[model samples]
Target: MSFILGFAGSNSSTSINYKLVRYTATLIKDPQVRLMDMAHCPFPMYSEDYEKENGFSNSLIEFKNDLQISKGIIISVNEHNGNPSAYFKNLIDWLSRLDRNFIKDKKVLLMATSGGKRGAIGSLEVAEKMLSRFGADITGTFSLPNFFDNFDIDKGILDDELAVEHANALKEFLAKITV
Candidate 1:
């Protein structure tokens, strides 16, 4: 069956961004959602020597295959010092090496959440810029500020206003990625 791939730009075992991805996946219907964790499918540091000596690992190849089959992607990025975390950035570096245009022509629904008020917006902006270089189109975005205050593990987005906004963003993303 056709599916959309959802993942968080985080390798942390307790990443809030991953929680957001899981919640978002539940909101999507029709095209099934496949959730992946960066922590689970690990990648070594990207380097010319590594690429030449090892080529693409089986795990990387499998990830690329999944991306190719995906109707779209949902990524909830995590911020570190106002940018994407080192682990996620490294993964992208290796992914680009595997196929410079692996994400090309894919529609993306970008989201981020953090403990702080900015809600990892800096990383979201950086990711948007970088993904554009790979030819991925960001069709919609949402950032949840003060994640703990506004979100509940079981109930999802807590505030009515934010819930409506999230729903709207999902609607926009669905319009672009699905027939």
Candidate 2:
């Protein structure tokens, strides 16, 4: 029984990215999924001073524990200026201090969503590259552009074709990783 962690980068209480991540996680079969929220991590801005003073917070320790034991990860990052949100990036920085290869050799499903043409654009690419440098084995990548129009709360993915496409992509990604 493989365990997977699912989370979005944003801390917004009603984050669409979080909702999408949760929905996507349900598409995977035979995996125990643990959904997480960035807000609960409660990490301050990434600074050497803060890190030295505070060390890894309890929530960060808990988050890392979950990752260390999981078989794979499902992450959906929210973009801020064509990059990872400050909150998520900060968390990653802190995790790296604990272990340089924090995500090394771990299977990863990387995704991002936004209301722009690029749909979190270069952020996903950048993250994949950086994480891979630390040995992250990214199995698949998904980007949802113009999220506001493409997805909705009541109906989920509004476009049938797009929905099928994303579902197939996510399923394929999970299949490659699980057993």
Candidate 3:
């Protein structure tokens, strides 16, 4: 069976993106899901000096291992100030230090959720650009705009129509990539 690494790119204790990522992972029918928290594996900010001085954090190395072993990834970003959250960028930077092409040949499901109208569009585009350059095989993308109003825990996706659309899109993409 394929295994998917699912993560949200925020460290907030009550992150809506985390909720959305988890929800998206659960929608996968065949693959086993392993949910990871960036908060649990925080790494120091990336710098060449830091890399030469301290080496990669053990946690960051382990996170890299997880990515290396996974068949696919489901990642949701939480944007701050129209960019990646500090926690997310730190992880990305640390991972890149191990290999400039950390995501080389990896399949990724890019997703984002936000409280505003754009749904973390800035961070989503930024991640797409960076990860693609690193050789990520982007399978699909999703965005939940105005997250608080669009999604409800009790009701699942508040917009059932949109939820079906997103779920179908994800399923199709995952199918294409897994083969």
Best candidate (score: lDDT):
1
lDDT of 3 by residue, 1-179 (tens): 55889999998778898898888877777778899866676577778898999987777777788888888888999898999888888878778878776778888989898999898989999988878887998888888888999998766578776687678768866886679
Cα RMSD (Å) per model? 0.9, 1.6, 1.5
Model 1 stretches astray by more than 4 angstroms: none
Candidate 2 per-residue C-alpha lDDT over 44-83 given as tens digits, one digit per residue, 9 for 90 to 100: 8888888888787778777888887888898888888888
| Candidate-wise lDDT, in order | 0.91, 0.82, 0.83
Task: Point out the higher-scoring one by lDDT: 1 or 2.
Answer: 1
Q: In candidate 1, what are the lDDT values of residues 1-179, reduced to their tens digit?
A: 88999999999999999999999999987689999987787788889998899898998889988987899999999999999998889888988888999899999999999999999999999999988899998998899989999999899999899899889988988888876
Tell me the TM-score of model 1. Answer: 0.97
TM-score order, best first, reads 1, 3, 2
Better of 1 and 3 by TM-score: 1
CA lDDT, candidate 3, residue 166:
74
lDDT of 1 at 10: 97
